[model samples]
Target: MNRRRFLRSVSALTALTAVEFAPWQTMSAFAREVEDFVRGPAVKDHPLRRISPHVWMIHSPDGFPTPENQGMMCNVTFVDTAKGLVVVDSGASVQIGEMAIRQIRKTLKKPVVAIINSHYHGDHWLGNDAFAAAYPGIPIYAHAGTIREISGMQGNLWRTLMEQWTNQATVGTRVVPPNTAVDHGQELKFGDVTLRIHHYGKAHTPSDICVEVVEDKLTCVGDVAMDRRIANMDEGSYVGTLAAYAALEKNAGSTIWLPGHGLPSGQVLQWNRELFEGIYQPCEKAIKDGLSMEEAKALVLKDPRVASRAKDTKGFDSNIGKYVSLAYLEAEAAAF
Candidate 1:
């Protein structure tokens, strides 16, 4: 199907599901429910908690607080080297990023020497400005395409979301771009630690790089292994995503997998493999059967794996249908 037809079909499916599932009516209620789920039963003094000795995971009490919210709680990793410190993905905003930096400083007082963006997603890079403001002249690293994509779209995305959510308006707000771009493989040595940056082309985004600290054996994967119900493929390629997972499995081994969201895991590759199989196989079957994206979504919904974690099965249908449409398009294009 052509892009226009495919988009129209997806829109129709969205509308159908929205009406059938009462998404609008339930949106507020569902948000409250999710808020409760995330907040947990007990009210802890510090919601933002530390995961490992060097890694801290900032939990968003309201989940995503604003439109500018990239649905990422910060995953800040502190590397103490003879030179200085190295930070992984910053939080969702400048404020949060600075907060994370302060939290990191509580442990170690070294200046941040460098930052490695896992991908071009706003949530991962929006906090770069805060880090830069705190420590000027610090070099940032990312995949070449990540810099281009974020530079092209970050301003608009930040503005649009800020207006919708925060009601604070400012134009010409520039996000700091990466100073160094890695095309394929590059090793960064900071005093005693060596970090291997591997670029997996066109995976979660046009440029997705996984940061591996060799000595620590910890791989900080940005959005590759979100603990959420489904993977967001809005800016990702289906085939490339599979290849990215394969590459991650080969390179990361069984070390700790620090994802952009949720608790850190040691079995990231296995989880990613399961996610791919759960979503892809059914999606392909639906496409081959000439079923509409909506039908494919329903079929996938029936899968026990998806059903087990589905927030609202009906609403899940709409979201999964869109992903199925994109994957189907990619699969069909590949056949030619």
Candidate 2:
């Protein structure tokens, strides 16, 4: 086999072992399908995984921006609410947003009446423009804090980052903030489907919201927990994140979780809790030992336990450094 073919073969074999079957089995299949497309030809057709009769999720690869993938980094979920389609979190760029629309059209021919932005993060919301352009007056819902963050300077900063990241995939992209501000514990009724939005204080972001489809028994937890890679700790609380996941488990045990990245699973919250403790305990010791934030960061990075946690992860090589630094700061602040 040639180098590219060999790599693709390796990718396919790895997928079988990497993805858990409990949740997102079809979603994992869609991701694997993309692997085939990524290695050859420029195609706009990224496969959609059927989570249920009413819900579908498109999984993006965990790699840097490229023309093939269109910088689609997050899990873009779509729900077919008897009345119309409700998109949960748009992709990272205009191309990806457009791709999602096409896939939705091909699958269900339903109008996209609503979009739920899970947080203020660019990768989760930058594709808002595509939906706004296609369906002129669709109500985009988000947490009140998320709406404020996107409407303010955060939108521009994210646009700039997207442009740089995707090599100008932001060409036609516009900054479209959520029109409807959804508060914590609010329920959005859409015909047969009712989505319960939860904001458990500051977890991934102050604006983070997890959407639970009451009937489907599935929760789309954006950035609150990840399947394979280490989640970004740049803008959220380590302790708060654990609390949010704990509340999720308490309220909805074994209900499938669709993470912001990676394959969906029932065990993600547990993995995230383990990841948080791994970082927190080591950094707390460094801080108690009179080490400065920078020193603590360095020591935490060198810890064998932390290093092993991310050894086999596909992406977030840089996030490990940022996570260690953030853990130090969080530990320092907790010292009070």
Candidate 3:
């Protein structure tokens, strides 16, 4: 998760969830040290798993970006389009992205025709520099809002944080924002494969767009449906996220869902839906019942499942408070 964005978004609620200090901030120095040691050249075998004849993905080990993983914590996907390859969500840094390209070359020796940015998150797009260098003039696709988010200092913010997190491993990783912007239902066909790009309003982020491969019967649902980690929804909408999951489920009949994180499965869409709704309803009720923010926070905090589930899963513990706060704000905004 982007720690800076998370801090900025919920800065107002710091006093409310003051039990935990700035955990991410406290680890910066240690993270830099780790990154310095582990930030090296890309490897050829980085756990690339095949889904079908044309679809394959690399599930970055679960947890925060570290030198050990070379900041390759986001799931990077590549679709073999026969003539060439199409990549979805580049790795977190230049090295990680380069690693993906090298790994892909092991089996599929096709040029990357196009690179798609699933969202504006730096982890998803910062690696664009690697692709642009390897495949010159390749068109990078994303939603207009995604372009806007990564255009200004936001991209730099991601880079700076990543440099610190990866011990300056991303020194040459410049931001190459998407050049082409696709609409809600734009379809692009390449070598007998047709990808239907979809923007389900504002779910995971304001600019999230999932890619559905028509022939492969697969949908790459960005951060809309993370596998086990508790997703950061500070820039997302509770209602819109629920609706997005519902829409994804409605269309996902036997279609494999390759999420931005974790393994690919059609089941996680419903899992994420239940997770969102499970937290949302209580918060909404707390709001409707005129309970204080502390009461709502306490309600979620007191729940044994919320605490237990977060503790059992990696990367989910530190984010529960943030998700509850965001859900509360989303519920309040929807009410007005």
Candidate 4:
């Protein structure tokens, strides 16, 4: 970026601490979008790999946002239906979404007719800006609470967060939240494919919706049960996540689980379940023993299941202590 543009982006970053909840960040100033087209550097095309019969995904190798990753932190999935492609999660920015669009054209040669955002996180839905412009009036769907949060100040907070995290590569990306609200047990049929929605209340977030392709027997779990990294529990609950996993298994019955940051597999759920049990159950035991949070962290780190995955889990060293604290607090709260 030139000096003038760099200065503007830096100025926006500086204002983040003061106006975090305020709607100070606007698309016009940051994204400079004109005529529904985003003006920014394009993310280099990432190859889309097929996970199931009709589901294909562009995998993001990086779990965290950085200038090198360009905020392409979430996997963008496409479900080929009779009408067209149904996007599972758009992406983190217009540039990344545009890259997905280019890949879609090259592989499927289909238009994105509908979009289902798994949650309200900008990394999962900010790409809606590109799709909204590319496919006018394309119905973007999400859970009602997801829609409410994104439509509220969460959109601004996430947009600014993405911009700051990616160091302005996500700049010029408009905050286009999901427009349609879907609920648990709802089914939407497109041409030949049927998507069944599942929401078990507050797994990764309060309104996270998992979309299952009935014919394929695989579900997009989003951040609810991630692979290779711990899902952020700041706005979530450990007990609730464990419960959500149980509900998903009982409802879906061993379907392949695809996450936004890792490879798709049938083992994803079990892997996360074991890892989470290792993290949360130890805290539960610690709380029962009247141990401190630091003691709980030690117990969690020593759990075989947790230790087995620590080498492979992204950000485990830096994040495990915080996760243990959340688990300890949740366990203590549940005890009372």
Candidate 5:
């Protein structure tokens, strides 16, 4: 806010302060209210839809954060179990989480019993703040790597990036990292439903954890796979990701894959695997052929698997080069 506007607001709050209220407390609260008022705007309640027998999700239409999206660029999946509700990837920010809570109250009216973070990315777990506030001492779960990164620089770094991306829309968001650590092959039971945690080394990130709902035949794949969108392998491995897909297929066979950014379907993993293959196989060949990164990118673009989905992939034009470079490096590292 401008100096004049801020002064006017402070004056109004000062006038409203009551004798019973402590002067310092009222002033402190007013300072916070003023800071909140300047944020881009609160996100409106997003609609929730059921994707499986027990999983309901708020699918974010956008693929990345922007002022327009208010940092609501990740899917908020709710697992309705016999016990209560288990949140898979809380959401992007506190505002987004609050919106999810609104939908929960309107639809299921169930208490959020637990939260599982897919990775350390802020968009996947920063909403832990809202849930923690609403359900005090809620058990927030994640992989050991995820917990470590989020508890360190990744937490504040993402918090700042979200604010910058949303132009202060996510200003009030806090970095509330997961409190509990889960690992591969861990099964968490919530009444009748069972959540099986699967972590096959590193795919999207070392911390990536896909939660499989055994009874429902569905798995929340986080960024390990996305529908109609290329996965970010910046902090990942193409060879490792393919291995993960193979492992996941063998274990959670034929289950619906719910992504953090797109629609949930049985074909999600296959689609992303093909897309990554299109991007990485070409790079792998190029590296073996002694070609440069630029040549590798050319082959990736020409690959039918990549070409066919080019028009439909979100951020394909702007982000493909970076992802191609990442794949090329991974391919080179593997070859060496």
Candidate 6:
């Protein structure tokens, strides 16, 4: 099947599912519209935005993926240290990464000392080539498993489908491996700055790391605490996600939190903790109750807190649903 046809079929199925099972009749109309928009042609470019001093937010503008079909957005952070600039998580594509590099060079002439991949996700690491090409021999850091995961995957049906559904161009398949790997907790020193890398295993991915810049009191939490919505767990464990969020809350010091996406929040640590406890926990509970995926989705829909965020919640459902499904799948696996 071709990409366009497959996307159209997926969009149709999503609309049908929403119409059939969505409890609120009012939601069906909006859901159908969202589904169509997601399967439509891609937008031109997602311009980068500077959210804080030495911190920029690289949004996909395409948004996150959903069952009804929506684009995915990833966050990248650029930190200016005394030694050189350190970038946290490259954007979705090489172009986006190049665009971000251009923005970084506008202010700072220091070479990119390092590139950190928060996890193994393509959105975070696919742009490594762009940066690597620009700054030759700059060290790239990631967890050991992350390097393995990216290197192991082969271009196949999934990649083709993703390109079609997300409107991403078909770039060559070249794996970007990390030179440095962090275990549980490792401290990296850059000039007078100290970045503590903490591995919160299997949260958003098998090899997620939260980078804390000690001198700046800034934490570039890759995807642990997304500002716009819940963290994506398509390839993670719910127990791990909970543990990771708890770890982030427990260890996140009184400092500015720079999430991979969304605005930096002063109360990010606490707000993210609350977001998990208030939103995800209940969704997990609903799944545990043997609610069908559709039913579980309805439960999330009813929550005013989740619903309030649902206004901008087109592509977010897929990530949330994936998390819910993973939680249930993990429970099932544990039962066996």
lDDT of the structure predicted as candidate 6 = 0.65
As for model 2, its CA RMSD to the true structure in angstroms is 13.1
Off by over 4 Å in 4: 1-39
Clashing pairs in 6: 63-71
lDDT measured at residue 306 in model 2 versus the true structure, 0 to 100 = 63
Q: Give per-candidate clash totals.
A: 0, 0, 0, 1, 0, 1
Q: Tell me, by lDDT, which candidate is best.
A: 5
Candidate 5 at 230: error in angstroms? 1.3
Q: How do the predictions measure up, each by TM-score? A: 0.76, 0.82, 0.84, 0.90, 0.92, 0.73
User: Which of 2 and 5 is the better model by lDDT?
Assistant: 5
Q: Which ten contiguous residues of candidate 6 have the minimum total lDDT?
A: 62-71
| Cα-based lDDT at residue 294, candidate 3 | 69
For candidate 2, the TM-score is 0.82
Give the Cα error of residue 156 in candidate 2, in Å. Answer: 1.4
Better of 1 and 4 by lDDT: 4
- In the range 1-336, model 3's lDDT, one tens digit per residue, is 455335434643543354355466555654454434434455335867889768988888755776555577898899988668999999787777888888888877788999999998888998898899899999999999999888977888998888778755565577888999997878989978888888889888888998998888899988888877767787788799888877766664436888888888767776676667767877898889888666787887666546545555566656776788888887787778
Q: List the residue pairs that clash in candidate 5.
A: none
The CA lDDT at 198 in model 2 is 83
Regions of model 2 farther than 4 Å from truth: 1-43, 63-68, 292-307
Worst 10 residues of 4 by lDDT: 29-38
- The alpha-carbon lDDT assigned to residue 105 of candidate 3 equals 84
| Ranked by TM-score, top first | 5, 4, 3, 2, 1, 6
**lDDT value for model 5:** 0.89
Q: All predictions: root-mean-square deviation over Cα?
A: 13.6, 13.1, 11.1, 5.6, 3.4, 13.1
The residue pairs that clash in candidate 2, if any, are none
Higher-lDDT candidate among 3 and 4?
A: 4
Each model's lDDT comes to 0.64, 0.80, 0.78, 0.88, 0.89, 0.65
Stretches of model 1 off by over 4 angstroms after superposition: 1-63, 67-74, 166-174, 311-318
Give the top-scoring candidate (TM-score): 5
Tens-digit lDDT track for model 6 on 193-248? 77888787777777788888776667887777767666666776666766876676
